[model samples]
Target: MTSGKKTEKYKLILDAAVKVFAAHGFHKAQVSKIAKEAGVADGTIYLYFKNKEDILICLFKEKLGELVEKFHLSIEQTTNAKDALRRVCEIHYGELEAQVDLAFVTQIELRQSSLELRKEIGKAVKPYIVLIEQLLLQGMEEKLFRQDLDVKLVRQLLFGGLDEVVTSWLIAGRKYSLSAQIEGTINFYLNGIKA
Candidate 1:
């Protein structure tokens, strides 16, 4: 069984890995560098992670899992679909705006992984997509969204659009606040769906 100390150390290593990877890129970041950043011995990294790829995958799991859980809570707090969507945007853009390392790793370095790693990352992202679909379905049920609208397509559009906005912002060296675009983003999608 893993002790609380072990769990805490694991998270520390994972957090350090984010900065190391962001600074050096995933391929160039070594286990020793991450260990040093975490203030642990080089061998301690092996105890927590199998390799660099494992560290990257674990980082995705930890970060995205936290975001997905927050999405669940955000949807629960909002009674209306539009409000829930706006809340989602708030969390998305807000998190990116709040953390430079997270934004850099997610938008740029994460995409540098191999196809297999990308596929694994995609699978890990399904829960968040399902959450979006559920919110869209709720809108349809309330007659707030068109009855004939495609939930899957709309979810894809919402996710893809928001993702592109963040990606573009990161690619531009993050000149502006991503959270500032939340309302415009909601209006852009909500315009077509309003019933």
Candidate 2:
């Protein structure tokens, strides 16, 4: 196969793997199942990934890399730190809403992987956290956020809160719109945490 065809095939397998992993947790999800989902021979997956764990890692990197780039570009267009943060929250929640299955794969099924896999996920997660930290620092510099606040702690809080909110929505069967709470949630964070 040409390099372009090979790359397309790899993405097809990865997309199918995401669906399969989301439907069946990692332990129960089989390579054959992913292969069937991808409409490729079971051996084809081996060509792109060493194993299932490799697929999970690639999924995280691809998804999270896109997310970080979007956040950076979105923030660049805004001057106010709070506005930028709100945009970030909006984008994050919007993504979860738009891609519910992928969100399930990410927020829930991904946690079932091994500790080593979790460590790899942590490395992929750093860029997203850094985006939040940069916003917090900007807010602090502008006296919009509490000057005494630890940037790392603030980053954790922002990410943790948003993550929990999304998880809750997913757990609740997505009965309500995740993006609907953006204003109140942003206000709560800003009022309580800002300087």
Candidate 3:
């Protein structure tokens, strides 16, 4: 198990990797570049992570893990299923907006990874998928969503829609408020979900 300081170093490395990866793209971003960005030796990077791919997976686990946690916590504060869904989107876009480098790393750099790397990335993303699945289940339970709807498919739709919108925002240089779309996105989701 990693100690507190070790964990800190790990996070520092991931943070640096985001900037390095975003600036250089995944293939062009070397472990040495990331280590330099993190102010650690390239060998030190291997001590904490096996390779560059490990760093990328670690980064996604760190960021997306936080998103899932925050989404769950925020949902706990609300009773209305629709409100819970909206809260999740708000947190999603707000977190991305709060870190442009991370936004670029996730939205742009991540896509440039290889198919195997992409599969690894998807495995790291299970938490977010399961969270959305639970929320859809809850919405159905509360009679706020269509009972006949497939929770899994609906989850794909919701996550896919939000993901595409954010991708568009990132691609467009974020000229508009990403969080500002919360209401409209929620409305679109509810129109499909509402019983």
How big is the positional error of residue 14 in model 2, measured in Å on the Cα after superposition? 1.6
TM-score of 3: 0.96
Question: TM-score for each prediction?
Answer: 0.95, 0.95, 0.96
Clashes of each: 0, 2, 0
Model 3 ranges off by over 4 Å: none
Q: Write the per-residue lDDT of candidate 2 for residues 96-135, one digit (tens) a residue.
A: 8998878998889766778899999889998999888988
Which pairs of residues collide in candidate 3? Answer: none
- Between candidates 1 and 3, the one scoring higher on TM-score is 3
lDDT digits (tens) for residues 1-195 of candidate 1: 469989999999999998998899989999999999999999999998888888888888889899988888877888898888889999999987887797788888868789998888788778888989988888988889888888898899999998899999988878887888998899988998889
Clashing pairs in 1: none
lDDT of candidate model 1 versus the reference? 0.88
> Which predicted model would earn the best TM-score?
3
lDDT assessment of candidate 2: 0.89
Residue 71 of model 2 has an lDDT of 88
Which is superior by lDDT, 1 or 3? 3
Report the C-alpha displacement of residue 78, candidate 2, in angstroms: 1.1
Cα lDDT for residue 4, model 1? 93
